[model samples]
Target: MTSRVLYLFGSAAPPVHDIAAVVRTAQNRGFTVCLGLTPTATDWLDPQRTELERLTGYPVRSRYKRPGTADVWPKADVIAFAPATFNSINAWALGITQNFVVGVVAEGIGKGIPMVTMPCVNAAYAAHPQLDRSIETLRGAGIRVLYGEGGFVPNAPGQGRPPAYPWHLLLDAAEQAASTP
Candidate 1:
């Protein structure tokens, strides 16, 4: 069976070209992509979601209510949250399934599937006590949390891209997870 990789989107700033690149790279690596979109993410890349679906030939879900409606929901093997916003992170940490991304993540955790979350928020939010607690909670639960490198640096001229350490590390983790028995 083809290994599945679900991509969850969070509320990041506009222009998610970096995310698009990551998704495209994963797709090229032969992983099926299931996109779960946080509502706020729609503001940055509305049509791109549909475009991603077209490119991957997989379903892109924006809400939890529409899952399994596409006939491929139960086949997921891994779940990854990239560019995870503080709101979505807090909600996931608290078991709040207010949207498709959190709902899928909750299900993945219940099933004991490997999960990876890349948090992309401002430094202040990343340093918040609640955020730390949430990260600890996720770590205790065996979820790999890839904190933004060198603090919360939004996509800027030289800093907005994925951190050098975390990106390859997460990719390696994903490869191992996909190859697992």
Candidate 2:
């Protein structure tokens, strides 16, 4: 069988710092990984950008390409938008595609790709009423969202432990998505 490509998108949350390790783990599971980041995440990881490309064997994309330009990454077999920020989660649900990460997911929904998202938001931001609506919307669309009890529970503001983000559960969900037929 051909390799399964996992398109991993991230936002500017602290867990975004652990993406390199996540990519490595994804690769070990036989996924040909492609990485996309929010603009702020791109800047935050600028120093490791080159190394990330080396690790994934694909450019780390943060913005849209020119209209006539070809897409460099393979077609995604599964998508994981982990470490999703409050803004990205809402934007994606609302079809706000100003950025590449949100744009891909917005379109990805109609393309029938299995997608998963786990927010890295804090308790303070999680309290916003819109967040629950957004999560339901995505889940209503068949996207497997890892939040609340079974998944990520928002930590108190200023108390986030980025290193402890549930990378394993996210990966497991992605693996399941790829295998579901």
What TM-score, computed on C-alpha atoms, does each candidate reach?
0.80, 0.98
Cα TM-score of candidate 1: 0.80
Highest-scoring model, lDDT: 2
Cα lDDT tens digits, model 2, 29-144, are: 98999999999999999999999999999999998889998989989999999899999999999999989999999999999999999998999999999999999999999999
Candidate 1 per-residue lDDT, tens place, 1-181, comes to: 5656655354554324455666776776667766666777765677687787777566666765544565554466677776677787888899998887787787778788888777766665656789888878887888878774532344433344443324445555566676677
Worst 10 residues of 2 by lDDT: 1-10
| Worst window of 10 by summed lDDT in candidate 1 | 150-159
Native RMSD of candidate 2 (Å): 0.7
After superposition, candidate 2 runs with Cα above 4 Å error: none
